[model samples]
Target: MSQPPQPPQPPNEPPQGGFGAPQDPPPGGFGAPTPPPADPFAKQPPAAPSTPPAGGYGSPPPPPPAGGYGSPPPPPAGGFGAPQGPPPGQPPQNPAYGYPQAPPPGQPPTQPGYGFPQGPPGQPGMPPQQGYGYPTAPMHPQYAAPQPGGGKKFSTQMQIIVAAVVAVLLIVGGGIVYSSSSGDDGGKQDEAASAGTDGGEGKGGEGGGLADGTEKAPADTKSKVGFQLPHPKVTDTTVVDGSWVTDKAYVKTGVNEIVGYDLAKGTKLWSIPLAGQVCAASRHMSKDYRTAIAFQEGKPSAADKYPSCNQVGALDLATGKLLWSKSVTSASNGDEPVRFNEVTLSGSTVAAGGTSGGAAFNLANGAELWKPKTDTNNCYDMGYGGGDALAVVRKCGSYDEPQLTIQALNPATGAPLSSYNMPAGVEYASIVSTKPLVVAADVGDTAGDGSSISDFFSIDAATGKLIVRISADADKYAADCGSTEVEKCTSLAVGNNRIYVPTEEHEGGGEYGDTNEIVAFDLTTGKLVGGRADAGDRYTLTPLRMDGSNLIAYKRPPYDKGGQIVSIDGSTFKETVLMVNPDDESVREAETSFSTNYAEFIYEKGRLFISEQMVSEPSKSSSLDDKQFLVVSFSTV
Candidate 1:
């Protein structure tokens, strides 16, 4: 930042499209849904979604086949995401991936290239379907009910709010279905509603896979028949993060409220309103996994040059009652708001770090533990992994330290455990996976802005010694980031003591790219296990993780909606494509790189939860409106 002004992209990190990190721009978030703050349910949430004949919950219907949530609704006559005629000024819907970069054959690139993926216009003979393409505004929302006298009422006691979404529900006589629309230029909009019948006739399935090839969960898991929670309406930018503790879901329902719902019944178990804004990224849980710690970013102060009001609070995950709380301090880099950069816990010790510095507190009663010297030593970025081991980089672009030093700290005492020094010429380094102990570094060309990852290293989590380094013949980190795109810092994924890397030749034909396949290497040995091929010539796929023992990667469709979730066998690399995309193509497209995606997908306790972000950007702004949040859960049973 000091040498010379590089091309400045948006400085502020958008919500990791799904549940992501601020410094990283992967849609949902930076860190994958590994642990805390990643998935709303701390560890595991509820069962699979199901459609039972009035007997959906308590009795738990007969189990479904592979991929829990039942199959698609027979691929609707027009296929998924097929638009139903447009609203009566909007240009004739050009069924194509609306990416601004590679404009449809005849259309020009949208102004201000943000580098997001765009969809191609409809093919000559197929129904229009775009997955991960340019997010387009739906033209079918803002519903109203007739008034008793002369006008319709929106908030009157007489107004009955029956449906929160009415976009698409595959399977006519079974799942919920309705259409919605929004303003074209990003103005105020609403989701359409319909007078849907409560019950319908449809056979519950043994197969959990949808028609489009989304994965199916186990038979014992329940399939999602409908949405359980209300769309989260947030007034601020606080992300609606969730966690699972004791068979319940701890979800942030609003700016000031965090609610715990009984996953089995979707019933309100408890609700805890924070004293300050809950920073989802600062989320942590104790060694016993009973208490949940989230940083309460207090209101900002106007006096200081760099002001922030932040605190750390712990709550009983089960009861939602306050356990303890204490104020926190950080090391500052003036002119920027002091935000908590990282949070971790070891035993009963709680630690946090920021641009300012790092501090530790007792987890039980929220008393000061000690102020360790984390800010000095040429390190500013603190990351945690391997459950409790805290990793910090020596040179975090703070003072032009030539080489990068990697150090492991005893989170409880903030004492050094193990340390390694990376060679010079490294511009940036990030701990990609803690479980597998991998770090990704961006060693930029000294003379240009062109950047690509320089190497991949496996370090000893306990000893902090270098074990293996792969700088060639490996997948370079996928450098693409977006408001809704997955994997902000793409490069690697770790699952079951194995590391998965996608080849560098996958994408970049246009906004979105494809990967030939993901290559697996033994976690400790760094030996190649196997490489699986992509489904098709341009199937854009990114590995999410080795979900359980099965490697799960998302096959990003070319369009804005209708992407497929596929699972690959870790051993055989055999892939199974499941019809799991929850976005109906009518939701808000994640638009700009700074815009938020419509939904963040998280898998917990065998069930898949979709956290829907605002679909339409508020007019006059190109970012998330931060006024809406919705969590839809699915399972296979």
Candidate 2:
């Protein structure tokens, strides 16, 4: 439909004028009557001879006499040129002036009623009247009524619509901002959903809804919690080296000293000082934590003399008395005296492997069970897989291209279970075994110069069959590879269904900084299953024990900042840091150097007993004089 027309302007307003000026009226005045002129451009006709009618063949009737020539047109009626009056039944023109003027012979003059205002008579330059009649009253003022302040006012419905639109915009914009701000929180929620809540208190517990109809409150509101470590009594001052906790006692080794303490009261149970001064290398406790076997290296007598012999001693857990002691001939072959790096006890079998060779002894009487011939200069570590199965690695061949040959043997009979020849070019390597699976890590080409190659391999522990080999850049197969230029597995702690591997990365030419990470792998599927646990620079991780669904680890930061006990979920690999050493805080200066090492771990009931060392000294120490042994307990939440 078309819109309504706009109101007209007032009658007194003049017509707007612009670019073209209006022409003046003809030469005669506007009201003067004149005959129509003939067309100037019309064609002229030829002149014709004078002709007379037949009946009056003579010139036109003689012109009427001067006085008879229409009698001077009757003296022009009223005046020189006045108009005649209208005939009967006709109205006169110029009603306001009461002057009558003749109309056409038959038509009547229209009566003047309501029309446009005319200009006063005799006005010199007025425009002609328009054909349409004017309004009787001055247009009745078409504008709307003035508001209180003469401003436009919106209708009630329009105001409501505008308010609703603005509200919707605010709601949409707020949702976008909230989602962007909570992106990380959303990822945490996803992780929680997949891993399940099993660490903190009240996190997975049930709660009732409040009266306001909101759901149960969040668990973080419960309360904050802290931890404390049980103190161990210090007996005699000694250069403690190795320590391990059994069910009822703690055993510690020092240079020429081996001591045992009661778990309940911290009283000295017994001490076995060595005959010849020596440093303890490694120690192991039986599965029941009732017996311990320690390996010690004999000190050299003179610069030219080779170290005498390596010794392994068995001790009773409760009484701290020696069970048996045995000595093996040195396998040094003109090198420095050999030392063991790992000793393990399983049931009645005790096994030790070192730079000398790998050996298993009878736990009943300290009798040599098996001693393998040495082809390598060193055997860094060893692991026993139940009954008679033992896994060992020996470093052999040339110094430039050292080879680590992994072998599974019957410890009781010294018979080979299986064996595999590893690749050359690796300098250091370690092996771990779990009945059916064996994993080995080899680090090679320590001189850098672009010849470095580090790799990990998995083997069937039962049959010594190669399963898979993983490289440092094998993310899909081994996602926990270290980020350092030299990537190798540092420690292995195995649980019932999973294996925990801690790897290290050394930065800055392997001098100043180091980073540690722990990765959990599913033994059955051989797949990585959890997020990497990152322990910052200069920190090292050692697996302590794996109990039920949890794998406990000991983390050592640089320079004796003490140590912390970290609990990792076996399934998800989520970590909870717990039981940090409290005594380290009492040291006087921040620049002092300290060292703390986790010796062993024993988990019983709901408590964890950890044996460790607390050593503090200057950054440069002339002698090992400031080390102390400690045993502490941590309660599972």
Candidate 3:
């Protein structure tokens, strides 16, 4: 279970006996990060022409065409047990214009066809979900850009089995190399339980094989047969957010509506109605991808009118079959503007509803397993704590000085297994991940005076126990959480026994040097890994994911100068720019803004899927931009 100790730093002056002193190492002991050394004056975009993102993370490639996760995880250990690279001679990636080589030809069909069929359990002969149309043209390809190069390849024998020290990941071995195929994709999902990290050099957990990241990546590349869908044109509503459920991408079409489209061959599968925006689908959730859950926003059903909204539903992600949908008994006013804050499932428990209140239900049938202990408290904001537990952040204490409480509940039965009462000064907190560890943030911890408590903490998921606390100013996990002290940064990926957080450290100033922007920390020690800064330096970058052995970053400047998407070598921490963004005035305006209209990026099947963005212009369904919701898929197959 004991990991090799962190290498000791060599003395500044090497011993005289050593053969000629080793050549000075680059920033990461190899090539330096991309974009050249950070230039403080007159910053311009990376010099390169690139096709605009048709869309949208792995650096190491996947066998699943270009996209990642083409196939399911190797079967779990016992009932649930555990959890790639290119070769030499062949180029690790395509060097032409940053576009990946055309993917192979095995991409799966997005759906059967353009027709919206009555999904799985729609009233037997029910009419196809009404008012949905399909796209008929081919958009641009979401090319897979070269992200980080493989750090160092490990032996094929090296596997990331469950370790005792909270999933102590031995990342150096070619065990986790850069995807020779996947390359830079967008976005990442939180890591689930696999390695152990509670005590000294903990080894493997031998936990269920749900998500140990040890399973072999797909061998077959996911080829994208020419496919594109027009942006959905709805006046009353807009596509807010969505998830890639297996082969199809489920997105919020409009008010209380969701539509699924095949990313492979541009097929319109099904369109289901929704009540509101509170929605959650098990996208990268290994075997849990079968179900999708969302809150029914808007006025309550005839059965319950006391609360303006009180309905939650779950459906089969692929089949469109209804798993279970229920309305809750609430004391809320019908006029309250609220939707289920969190919708998650653990084991057999399906939980949907808002932070105000929610319940865990039976996955087999629509049965309420249990509700939160108190209505005044928030619902399941705390995500699933690895297995059958769900973490919930609730408000307790006097309103003027409310206290934050986190509860780990039994997903099947709303019983509190453990609860952590956060310190008093913290009024509100949000949960980022429950696995690896319970990471929560007190977003309200911002004040001019240093006394203001902007704090972030990690806790033990199984028990209501606090692990470590850092200044929220130092590292606020939430990207958009309002904080002026630092440039906005988000923790993009969690893997290999570490959490990757990228920040530009942009605190209102043009005086910026190439300081380490991306931060990777040990999941257990919470210490900077490798005693080295990230490879994202010299350029303003947004950390995306750990592609293969590299760290992919999006060089989307807030302005319109056409930026580049680059990757940082994991081992060397060297940066390489892969794709470039167009700098035309139109492209700049659309991408530079902090508008809520920004497209949602999701990773599935090795491909990065980007949903349509909310545009500034009003509707004219005939316009390609408004009429259809755009879904672009990228890969490095």
Model 1 per-residue lDDT at 525: 52
Instruction: Compute each candidate's TM-score over C-alphas.
Output: 0.54, 0.49, 0.52
lDDT of 3: 0.40
Best-to-worst lDDT order = 1, 2, 3
Highest TM-score among the candidates is held by which one? Answer: 1
lDDT of 1 by residue, 1-637 (tens): 1121111111343222223322111232211221212211111223544654343333222222333221222322333333345668776664333211223566643332122222245432111244463233332223244446755444311111111011222121122111112323211112121112111112223333232223454433324433344344333234444444354563443445567776555677778776654543333455344443444444433443122335556667666776776665544544443355445555576665544555677767877776545444465543343243455554554456465667776666667678777766664466656554676664444312122345567888687788877442322323222212111234346776766665433322112223234556565555554344343333445565455667666554332323444566766565554434433322212211121122445555445555533222233432342222255444442
Looking at candidate 2, what is the lDDT of residue 634? 37
Supply the TM-score for candidate 1: 0.54
Model 2's TM-score against the true structure: 0.49
The order of the candidates by TM-score, greatest first, is 1, 3, 2
- Clashing pairs in model 2, backbone N/Cα/C closer than 3 A: 560-594, 560-595
Query: In model 2, where do residues sit more than 4 Å from their true spots?
Result: 1-239, 277-283, 288-309, 330-342, 354-358, 373-389, 395-402, 434-436, 446-453, 472-491, 502-518, 523-526, 530-543, 554-566, 574-584, 587-637
* Model 3 C-alpha lDDT per residue in residues 1-637, reported as the tens digit of each score: 0111121221331111100111111121111122222223114445543643232211112112222221223322321112222356765653222111222356422221222232235332222222343211221122122237734332111211111001111121011111111222221222221111110111122211113222122333222323434344333222243455464554434335556666554466777766553323432232644554554445334664322334556666666555666666533524443344345666677765444455667766777777655444433232333233466666665657776677776666767777788887765454545564444454454533222224446677677677656443333222332121110113355555555655433321112223224555554554444422222222344555556556655544433244344445554444444444444443333333222113455443344454443322333433322122254444422
lDDT of 1 at 268: 76
